[model samples]
Target: MASMPGPTDAFARPLTDLRVSVTDRCNFRCRYCMPREIFGPDHAFLERDELLSFEEITRLVGLFTTLGVHKVRLTGGEPLLRSDLPTLIAGIAGLDRITDLALTTNGTLLPRHAADLAAAGLDRVTVSLDALDDEIHRAISDTRVPVTAVLAGIEAARAAGLPVKVNTVVKRGVNDDEITAMAAWGRREGITVRFIEYMDVGATNGWRLDDVVPAAEVVERLSTLGPLEPIGDGTPGGDVGDVQTGPGQVAERLRWSDGAGEVGVIASVTRPFCRTCSRARLSSVGELFTCLFATSGTDLRGPLRDGATDDEVVTIARDTWTHRTDRYSEERTAETARDDRVEMSYIGG
Candidate 1:
């Protein structure tokens, strides 16, 4: 098949990844992404009628593929909360031009659905697990769910033939002590573990600059466990498949000197990669956000539900992306970071 025409934004960044939020409800209220005080019992979530149907999501995925999105990741407040999610996964996997299809989850429910999801054509799974200690894990997730259950979920994903990458968000006073433990565990388990700097992504996370444990510090801390070598230095003239530590990638790849394992650090707060960011996010309600820190999104739900044609939806998406010049992370400041941004739960982290 002929390749789809590539669309570039004002900064000339091509769109290649799309994160689709299937739902806006989660079982756990992580302190970073979703705090309990704000998202309390009375907090209202999107009704079923407000969400984009599986068919609608599939249509948008197809449209996005036509504009150079070969990778699609299913995300949510917790995607497992969505009913019959495997059906949506199958629908998206059936589409042409999607080279990669993955999902990001908290892993509370992966044990029950891992095999089904793999059968439905999921390529890989990125599980969010912060601490291995039960007490710390419970505190970070703000739930009674045990750490053992999440580990079981990871094992289940592996058993189902799905490659797994574990994501741990490191906050200074919160879970920074677990850096070596998490890295050691990843090395032993043979799963690539990534440490993400605590970011001021949404308006309600009560973000503070002091809370962020810089990626450099994390790598330095890991070196105490074993010698670490940086992978993918952003140098010119390397193999095409070689991971380049440059713009667009959220993570800086690294490996153990002993060759036991590899790790990644996502320093979006400190080492911003806005120049080559190729991701566009779609909310469960069908709003298209050009940037993670965007205050507003183009409401595709209105146009689609109002009987707009496929070509019309494609034009809206293409035009919105074509005119994109978002570099919020690169320009983030103490004052600017406090600006009202969409809640990460509404979209996806």
Candidate 2:
């Protein structure tokens, strides 16, 4: 396949990363994402037929690669919930243009599939674990599954030779108290722990400004555990000393001064990095979303199902990216923050 030059958005941000949601089904209903009240048993998820097949996903990825997407991250309500996911991983890995093939999951199912995923050419995995306390974790996840189960999964991923990163969404009055403990645990395990501010991704999480524990506050609290050296300028578009900063990395990297370990804080709320954002998300059903807070998406599945050629898909992708002007985080006011946006579970975080 001949490579086409990738397109840059209106802000001159090149499209380099693609997040594909494999499924919309998840077992745990986290309040910030799939709140139990909204995603209840009665809630209707996409039918199996509605999801993009492995072949279709691979085909789109091939087109995306031509448009300058070098990294592909598989996500979902729970990507592991999708059946035979390793096969999909292997298919995407076979692509020469895809330099990085990763997945983000809740970590409960990693114990069962981590080895298989690694063998199938998965480069890395990011596990979402909000709290270390069993009760806090249960309250956050709204599932009976305990913290030990998730920890075991993390170990399983490491044992399978897959580098792991733990993501924690710190919300005030929810699990903010566990920030230090979570960071210490990740340090002990020699894994990078990233703290994310509670964001208003969807309308159902009861998102309130007061609920957010700013990244600065998180850093302050983590510093109490040990001296934390700013790993970078801690500003948008700043250089990362020796570490290579990716195209759309929102996390401000930091390291413990004593060399225990490194941690990251994604202050999307307090310090938005929208200017350097270069990611495009595709839902399980193939809707292309340029922004996480977008209310609508371009229906790529329709074109794919209609037997549109690769050139046609590429045109749509390039045009959509070229016109992209989304910067929700930077412009998030109280009024605009409550706009009806796509669910984080449906499009991946």
Q: Pick the candidate with the highest TM-score.
A: 2
Tens digits of per-residue lDDT for model 1, 1-349: 2445888999999998899999989999999988999999999999999999999999999988989888899999999999899999999999988878999999989999999999999999999999998999999999999999999999999999999999999998889999999999999999989999999989888899999999889989988988887675721111246322234557777779899978888888888888878999999999999999999999999999999988888889999999998999899889987899998998998
Mark the regions of model 1 whose C-alpha exceeds 4 Å error after superposition. Answer: 1-4, 234-247
- What RMSD does model 1 have? 2.2
Residue range 1-349, candidate 2, lDDT tens digits: 5778789998999998899999999989999999998999899999999999999999999889999888899999999999999999999999988888889999999999999999999999999999999999999999999999999999999999999999999999989999999998888889999999999997889888999999988988998889887765765433534323544777788888889978998888998889999899999999999999999899999999998988888899899999999999999988987789999999999
Whole-model lDDT per candidate: 0.89, 0.90
- Tell me how many clashing residue pairs each candidate has: 0, 0
Worst 10 residues of 1 by lDDT: 234-243
lDDT score at residue 98, model 2, on the 0-100 scale:
86
TM-scores for all candidates?
A: 0.96, 0.97
TM-score of 2: 0.97
Which residue pairs does candidate 1 place in steric collision? none
